[model samples]
Target: MKTAADIIIELIEKFDVHDAGSRRAHGKGEHHKARVELNEAGKDIFGEVENAVVRLSNAATNDKVPDWLVNIKGCSVRFNHPLRPIDIIGINFPYFPFDSAAETLDVLYRIHFYLEDKSAGRFMDIFRAGGLYRDLGKILKWMPKSTDMDHLYYTAHSYGGEHYKMKLDYHPGNDRIEIYAEKDEHLIDYHPGPAVHLGSILINPHSTGKEVKYFDVLNAPPGMPPNGNLPLLRHYVYKRSFLRRMEEKLLDGKDLRMLEEVWAEEKYFVLSKSQRIYDEIRELVKKGTDMSATRFRELLDEAYALKYEEKHLRNYLQHVWGHFKDEADESEKAHYTRLSEHPDPEAVNTFIHDLAIKYKEPYILRTTMVKTRGRS
Candidate 1:
């Protein structure tokens, strides 16, 4: 029976808005006090949104606060929770500056339409305007994957110069561009043969050449990690090299095939009818910001009543919109209808539990045959 206003009221109550008032005191007479006040108001609105999400899920409270409320650098809020441990590791990249009116609109459109987080919108504004890491050591730490190998992983943006050594020969001066410090001695070794090279004749499970896979930054499943690698960096490091090799192979009249194959896999999650509430939130983002914060929270409450909030609402929606569109035949409808009729919570739970296990299982390739038929 709770309305969106009710849900919004509950969520806004959780946050101490007075915290903003005290924090602004430190700013004294500066504009920062005004900024703090605005942020506090934004946070209040966000609380309403968060409350709506909880109501829609119809689930118990969690110790981990939802990711949206988490403020990074008192600026951008994370869009959502990271899916995996590795997903938490973030990489710094340059964003196009927002200056012109068109540029500002373009940026906002991307954020509102695709990114779906206002705090993210703010962070992008600051970083995109030409920021720098002056004293590297104070901010970031570069630790090696192993003491033996030259490979390094970055901890923070300030110490990012540690990665400059690896790319010093090929791309000098701009230390931020190529920052994963690893030895680059064999960079040009991709070519034909069983040895996996860039212009290799054939690539398969047994091939030993380099392989490339592009991870979707925005469309990744909810439980997976966040996109940390810069798209431009990936393009420069892999796409450019791959394209060059592909052109070379084409000139030599070789048939091209997918070098790295991603086998289609189904990942599932079990949730009660109440948990499916995230769908409302997802749908809301697609809608323009026409609804006041109060109205959106109301829709969320009704949504939570239908499905128990589980971990995979985003994943489920992705699969449905992407794969099930054409497959919604009579049988599929019957299947959902049957579930609705009987509502086997245990069966759904079991299915999801099994799926989680399956997802966690890593791929292992077993060779049944080896081409002992050697040099041609």
Candidate 2:
């Protein structure tokens, strides 16, 4: 039985032989067009049911993989029983390719040519920091094209538990490519079964899940779902939910500013606070203690009893106001005017406390009560 390392070594050897032959036939430096030739023997060894091809192309002169000849592979697979032109196999690279075939081979061979290794992990880290999908979009255009295939499938391992899969359909006569993906829940799995197609667990005989859903990539805004910054998406959702709660409460300007301050404070705590703080707060609220206006003031005072850092508070308020300024309506404008008047501190304190209870966001009560020496 050939291990993954063995398989990779075999494939590299085959690619070397083919590359040398191509260089000889086309004359050195003359073969500008990239080519992908399938190796049936290597495919069988790699446990691929269909043929796999070695794709040779010039790597982009960028920070990702500067000035190198890249050799990657894609499998040829037929889908649907009476297979139509939808058959395609997408291959995802584990890391950015090195500059030359020798450099690439050396890096892979050093890692025993395994897909998941420290080197591969480093490559993935760099790839993600460099914008995973954006870099992929550039490489996809350089790959060999086939008229027989209707879609190109690309897959990658994510830092999260799930994997990433993208299906790209190129226009018949142009450079435009339409991207699609299986439903988010089905795209990746932590405990993936032997055959998990999209989100359905195929190994279980009693499974009755419907076919996976796919959505057009273009429908989502740039830097949003399907292929965008997940953290940014999460933050956006949190902000929207927070804003909605504020609207429901009809919070005044001062009230909004206080909540925004606490939110900023909580953001800083994400790096230092223990899960215990979050858990304890959730449990405290769940116990259903009366969190009336007085109780709210008590919590606020307890969280920020010292001299409050007015500068930090003002900065956060301005930052949030800037975000909503363009979208502010007449009512919002009036609220801002009221807030600018600086309502009584006791009233503002009560409002902040009430908001904490109402929204179940205790972190908002935890503000920097004291201004440190030498700081504004």
User: Among these predicted structures, which one has the highest TM-score?
Assistant: 2
lDDT against the true structure, per candidate, is: 0.24, 0.31
Model 1 clash count equals 24
lDDT of 2: 0.31
Q: State residue 251's C-alpha deviation in candidate 1, in Å.
A: 53
> Where in model 1 is the C-alpha error above 4 Å?
1-287, 305-341, 345-376
Q: Mind giving the per-residue lDDT tens digits that candidate 2 earns over 148-196? A: 3233435321222233343433332442233333323332222222322
TM-score of 2: 0.24
What TM-score does candidate 1 reach?
A: 0.23
Candidate 2 colliding pairs: 68-99, 90-153, 186-199
